[model samples]
Target: MGTFDAEGVYHPRPVVADDLDEATLEDAVVRSIVDFDDGDIVEGTVVKIDRDEVLLDIGFKSEGVIPARELSIRNDVDPYEVVSLGDRIEALVLQKEDKEGRLVLSKKRAQYERAWGTIEKIKEANGVVKGPVIEVVKGGLIVDIGLRGFLPASLVELRRVRELQPYVGRVIEAKIIELDRNRNNVVLSRRAWLEETQREQRGDFLANLKPGERRRGVVSSVVNFGAFVDLGGMDGLIHVSELSWKHVDHPSSVVQVGDEVEVEVLDVDLEKERISLSLKNTQVDPWQEFANTHHVGELVYGRITKLVPFGAFVQVGDGIEGLVHISEMAVHHVDLPEQVVQPGEELWVKIIDIDLQRRRISLSIKQAAEGGDVSAEYRDAFGEHAYDEQGNYIGYDYSTAEFTPETEAQAAWADYQPEVEGTTTADEGQSAEPSDD
Candidate 1:
């Protein structure tokens, strides 16, 4: 060793250049190492590897010792994989001197100091945090984003997740939905994945629908007013009024969840993002069939269903019903419909009037004429007939065979000509063709 004087000239101290005192040098080094303190964050070059500890040289007389546990932040990891000779690593000094007079250093605490701020920034921005699934815990799994994060059993997805083992040893990106640094806990979620996807699907669904389009869907859900159906990817509402031409009490009466159905698109409300569908619109309207099939004076059998103050409703067919008013019930007189027939009673009714556009049909039981007197004019026009209690004609007026008039004047005059002889005329309402007399 050399000493520097005040004038900056060096003076050498006595020393044996040969046969060096190795033992005294070792003793001084040990004494200097014991004087060092722990809990100091320091930098060092990886010097040596002993049986279970890593030796680092930080320019101290004696190198610091980091046992296998203190060597890395992760569990069950080999220190050789993280550091090598000549590799410069920084660590926190844990013990000034251990029982073996070795300085103890830890790599994990050194890493933690650099990690906390980065984690906080990611959480504040509501950004995605990347991590490795390091361990599987009781209610969730642990991840390493240079810090411990807890992902709950729930919130794993938009739907519930049943198995979590497959997540281990895998690295994934998750939204930091919850964070608390004081307790060193972090919670993450994949719900953002599901919501974003459904939003996309909803937009696609709206684009696919339009008015008067015939399409099919499944009954997705039932409410008091209607059923919500899944039309491919979108949802539509089948309102109760549109369910049937008949009567519908509730949607559940005819539809159920998961039931596949065909529906007609009646209207599209883009502003409200709603669709109105009709089940009955997809079928043949019976009132339309009735308009084409029946006429005045035509006889039809119907089952009495509902009674009201004005009339009784008779179901003639699936969706066709006629109302027999109280006045229409008697050629003579009647107080109530029940006075002529009871509900569920099947009877012959004559079509008195029909409004195809309004879907109303006026029927008369009295037109059957079961007991009321038939005028000679009607008897001659319609033939001999029996009347029902409500005045509905029940028997054929056979006078079609006995009457004939030769001319227009003769035909018009036939009714007034007295029932004295044979007659054939259209004013008597004869057929257009006359038979040879």
Candidate 2:
């Protein structure tokens, strides 16, 4: 029996137990039980996995129930795929006690909360975030950067990538371009990261690049003015004029997108971050080659490329054209070049003057027709004479010559010649002559 002493309260009997340790054990159990509230993040060990839910023992009064949908940011995933039994994981308390008196937890929200803090720090530091592409949505992809992050298709690469399915399951690095915690929206750009990396690479590339240095590249894009080539680090422009040794009407005519080409560095503007490239400069100069093998006073066959006010450009070699002045088109003073020779007409022409230094060659159709040795003035000036096998006077007959199909096919100036004397000409125009400089 026991008696109450202090306040004159009634006494209750105390039973004497075989062991007093049970009372201490019950007190220890009460102290071991942890208390949690909604939105609290708690760590636990996965105790069991089920078809639609997972059971985690967070040392609460009851095991915490995590629905499969709340297990991961990825939708329609199996709970087993997200967590395994005995694995330690952190979860957010969704409900201290659900309708069934069970503790409810969400693994995804906990990860999301932690991710936001980390991402904010990364964004401030201008660091890159990497994650796997989990879903392919319209206009973009969903990357698992702790939470779903949108990566637009246009900002996925340096160039727009039409096919986004290939990106699924691939891990990629990106910069956080936008962040909205209230809306739970995050926008990412892989291109930004790539461009930043390329900027550094471009600096190094530009520093080492020298004019006239040959380099290999891939044609990235072709525009009206020029084609842009990716020279490993930066893009250099190949102007339409420098695309070919022959005259080029358009950059696409010489190189197409995705074409691998060898190019010469014509100029490097570090201040402007511009590079001038020449595709034709990397190849042999047709004019130089023709000058080496051909000579003044010799007769060569050519097609009338264009009939200008002053002259007709005649193509005698690949990428090489000589001007036949209107005065030299015929023995009789010619008012128009088309009257004596029409564009697209194959003809023989005599080279009367060659300025190798200037890359200009003066040709004569009338002189080629005249039955005479090289002219006295030309012979006296250049000291070369045009003679036949019997040493008789022989001049080329320009009117009777025909071009081989292969030659006509390869000629760049075979398209549309400029009109002469109000008549529409059907041959291609001559390309602008190479700069003497």
Candidate 3:
């Protein structure tokens, strides 16, 4: 066959039988490629694969060579992963024929066209897709999402990840965040995928959850106000006050991050998606039990837990509270509570009052202040003491062993007029007070 060149020169390649026969052959050739429009995807067999390009036979007279640059949508993917000899492939027709009489084709572009359709439908339906992490670029990662999809770093994981290299070569599932076929832009997010999935699941989980139900969870975070625990698929807030029976400034004082814990669901607000759980609610309340075991006017031993300006807080029973007033330190007045009471000191106190409704107990150290039955010993050692044998001492303890009055009683022998002692004897006693009776 002979064809005219662009320079108006004629070249003879082969000779045919007649003009009609030549026309028939040319018609057949044109008809074979008539449906092969530009951008249309067509299947072919790999004729050869080389470092520079791959040759494919798509029932065309001339084998088409796809350039290495066109083998993959990603810049870093090795061409060897794309094709092998004698393997079937689909490609987009770049042109019928180029200057070299060779068919131009692109496998990546064909896949790209199909990807646009699939990605558009998936994105519209809010569906998920899986792919491998091709590379981690600035602010995001490139995933081979049947196409090069941009996944923001913020959305790469359910939570933010510091290192991104570990994600490479790993397959991941993600939701399509954005998609544009005209501009060939696609954005993906793993976080959104997980959140959407969990949102659906959490609704059902809450539907079955009820108050007073016990469940196990992991401590997600320990904050000052409370600890947030993740109960399998949901999270519950454990207030600091309900964390334990002991006093705590923060939830971390008792529970730690990632600790497995059992909790009772104290409250649940489905509308707000809130669950109030308690770690201490499972235990028996000490104050409730103490009501039956003890009563007012009974002597109970306790330790000083804390002190305030007015009184000292004493721990009566397991979580019970009792106040010892400053005046109760002894029968005498006390200027400060700390003067006689120290924290953690053990003392025997008489229960003066118990407000069960308010969870409070009033104790008096003064009622038991006499050290119970020490009267006889104090009466014999008294040095001008005015105390009755019932353990009442008017003066404070100044001397080492006992309390002595500021004034001494008159000598007993002196009351007998001291035998006149020279001048005042019987004369001073008889006529001194004649007028008054």
Candidate 4:
């Protein structure tokens, strides 16, 4: 019979001389035994599988024993599930012989050893690694790429995911961000892979998305300052100011996650990979709409929304407000807007001037009290009794009209009041001091 060498090569026994000594024959027989030490990797075939371990025939005098714990990186794995009988495999020598006089091998360590070199090369070349998620660890997922790899939850997708359980058993591709063979650690980022693959698509999308162009997108996330919209290829930011035509308390109030909305592309920063969107732009500008329908000297009803040091903010229309300066609050000298109007008080206000460019609308409660032509919106509410055929106000009870500010420009200016109390007039030259609106 032949004996296996250190390299597992079979060699026939040397022919013995007729006068050979017993000690010389013993030396020759011992030399035929395969030479191996701990840490050496060896090839073998599965000869037996038990609940606790698998036996491998590695051409050694005795079969090598692989404990179930060494079968896979996963904990509490069944040995039978890892390997079947007669399957060829590789294992790392852990012990020449334990207390039971058995050769112990580690399959997982051998796999890790082989995978380390390949993983290092891939990381150096900036290549992607493909693997199946084997376990869900704290803060990340574990992938089986011959060896265990960590994929952080934050780097799993373009956006951070809160749940990680669904990733187990799924094969995925990722970029190697960090590798430490000494520590047996490998960190991967699927987001990096996704971003790298989608770069060209994002560029094309940004190129085609022009300013003022309307787009349909889903709200991916809502932050305190803005909402992020997924515009197919990339995410665009809709600042809180652009979320709606009126003051927004928070971005979430205007848009929630997963809400489909039509938005206007305000700006695109290719260098920064940023997209600025405007939700209010796609819809009609309440200010523009108000300007188109209302004009100077038109009477509208309003509710005193807020009182500022310089004037009062009056809501005249949905999401629209106009400033009633202290000078225009009443015909007489007024120390404060509160002297003429209290919050929640409903009254008539005359549109003094509409500066569409500056987004300011000058309104006057004094002029409204003096009586003027009611706005088109109120003309119907009062019927023909409030106006003559010429569209001029004949007579209407100021206490009963339900007109209100209908311009966002008026609303924007409601918070900004001029320190100097002055009249807002129909003549352009007589316009009040332009406050920062």
Error of 2 at 63 (Å): 0.7
For model 1, the local distance difference test gives 0.69
> Weakest 10 consecutive residues, lDDT, candidate 4?
409-418
Report the lDDT of model 2 for residue 303: 83
lDDT accuracy of residue 85 in candidate 1: 65
Q: Mind giving the per-residue lDDT tens digits that candidate 3 earns over 155-218?
A: 9766677789888888999998888777888889999988888887988999899999999999
Each prediction's Cα lDDT score?
0.69, 0.78, 0.73, 0.81
Worst 10 residues of 3 by lDDT: 428-437
The TM-score, computed over Cα atoms with residue i paired to residue i, of candidate 2 is: 0.80
**Can you write out model 2's per-residue Cα lDDT over 228-297, one digit (the tens) per residue?**
9999878999988889878788887788889999999999999889999999887888878887777787
Q: Where does candidate 4 stray beyond 4 Å?
A: 1-38, 96-101, 308-311, 325-336, 383-386, 396-437
Range of the 10 consecutive residues with the lowest summed lDDT in candidate 1: 428-437
Tens-place lDDT per residue, model 1, 257-370, is 899889999887766778899998898888887777766766666778988888799887677888999887755566776776678877656677889888888987765432
Off by over 4 Å in 2: 1-23, 371-437
Q: On TM-score, who's better, 1 or 2? A: 2
Model 1 residue 240 lDDT? 86
Each candidate: RMSD? 14.9, 12.6, 13.6, 9.6
The TM-score-based order of candidates, best leading, equals: 2, 4, 3, 1
> All candidates' TM-scores?
0.54, 0.80, 0.69, 0.76
Worst 10 residues of 2 by lDDT: 428-437
